[model samples]
Target: MGINLQKGQKISLDKEAGGGLSHIVMGVGWDAATGKTGMLGGLFGGGGGNIDLDASCLMFDEQGNQTDAVWFRQLRSRDGSIQHTGDNLTGEGEGDDEQIKVDLSAVPANVKSLVFTVNNYTGQDFSKVANAFCRIVNGANDSEIARYDLSCQGSHNAMVMAKLYRHNNEWKMHAIGETGKGRTFEELLPQIKPHL
Candidate 1:
């Protein structure tokens, strides 16, 4: 089982995995909040409709400048170190709805951090999203290392979910469940700076 992380919590990937990790998969999942009790039903005049949430990875240098991004519009980063699987239109079935793959060793030397984010591209606030979560999986063995729940109900449409950063040549995961308003990752750049 993987550790359940709270907002602002940080964990060393090396220690959690028992050693260094070469490849990792960051998975994001969610389900549309159902019933009239849900925010969507109360606020948006609807209930149990599809929510299109997008998962993205933003790479940054030591200076906190965005170096590259891998998102729905751009499936792969410039250096090819990160790749987004695809976009999931409906917050539907089972496990992860979307995933981003990262090659830690292949990441450019200048890149110091990788920030993960989720945005409601369809503009539905998180109150309508249920069971939202982001998890880190050891790509080699398909074992989850850690997970952060993002099911907090709110009016915000985007969340700076978590980040993976280089520390002493090792990578660490930090949970930052900062909610904000944005339809895309680019709009959340300012909100992501302080955390880096």
Candidate 2:
């Protein structure tokens, strides 16, 4: 069980069992939205189609400068602190479509923040996506800590979903469901800057 988070919500990464959370996993999932059928559907291959959503994490130093990125193009960070499970071409799974595991204790000291993002790799806008969600979990116990869902339909193809950052010597997760356009992380960088 986890706290169902809304856009702009923030939670401290303190463990309930009493110590700092050493490992955390960020999970993102989504499915294609059901669209019009009949003539309109026929025009677009009958409405049902796979949505390829790519989950990515960008690490930033104290100055909000990106220091490392973990995505399909690069599976792991330079310091091996963050690792993307793999790419999910279709949002057909029951749980997280893509997972990015992070060893909080292993993260470099200079790295002050980590932003998690998702982009439509197939160039489809989020109006074609449904049930899209982003979550954080305590890896050691496999317990969900917080989750955010992009429940509304939109025309954008990417989003700066959420961020995990160090504050007051503790980690915190912020729900930043900001919509943008990009097929990859590089293209989304500019949009992400304002959110930093």
Candidate 3:
């Protein structure tokens, strides 16, 4: 269901040319009716509401299944690779802001590329989502790469599937779709996948 990124390992946008490292900006957005859509206030969230009670909930137990809300994914040119990850949940502000750090040195041998993703965790109420968009760039030098846009807007929070890019290119910013419901990872998954 997700990819886990540790300390080391990665791939380049261009293997022969050497995939320059950058910041991939994955952003997700949606109109929400959640009150106290920030930290602390969500502590009161329970069954009556769907907001998470914790502000630092990168992962949570959804319907008895333990899933990580935050993660990092990589694609290897040799063995199978993970192109996306889970950003968990953060009911802090307007968007469900989550980030995964990237280092050129972190690219593992044979790795080709990567995709940063956010997990959705909305209950059985969101079914009106439309799209998920992603932007790539070298966060340090601020170089941008190709972008992937989809019509995936939904009724609840969503898991930013991922902003994919080649490793040999100048990598950078990533934008994951955030349509509300950041209190928990499970409640935010719907914003990314409309059919999920």
The Cα RMSD in angstroms, rounded to one decimal, for candidate 3 relative to the true structure is: 11.7
Looking at model 1, residue 156 earns an lDDT score of: 95
lDDT of each: 0.92, 0.86, 0.35
Q: Residue-wise lDDT of candidate 3 within 129-172, one digit each (tens)?
A: 22233334444554444344423445444344443333234432
Stretches of candidate 1 exceeding 4 Å from the true structure: 37-48
Tens digit per residue, CA lDDT, model 2, 1-196: 7888888888887853246799989998888776534677757675456789999999998888999999999999999999999999999968899999999999999999999989998887877888889888889998888878876687889998998889888888888888889899888888778767
Estimate the lDDT of model 2.
0.86
Q: What is the per-residue lDDT of model 1 for residues 10-95, given as tens digits with 9 covering 90 to 100? A: 99998998887999999999998866365655676564567999999999999999999999999999989899999999968899
- RMSD each, Å: 2.2, 1.8, 11.7
Relative to the unseen true structure, what is the Cα RMSD of model 1? 2.2
Q: Which one is best on TM-score?
A: 1
As for candidate 1, its clashing pairs are none
Candidate 2: where are CA atoms >4 Å away? 15-18, 37-40, 43-48
Pick by lDDT: 2 or 3, better one: 2
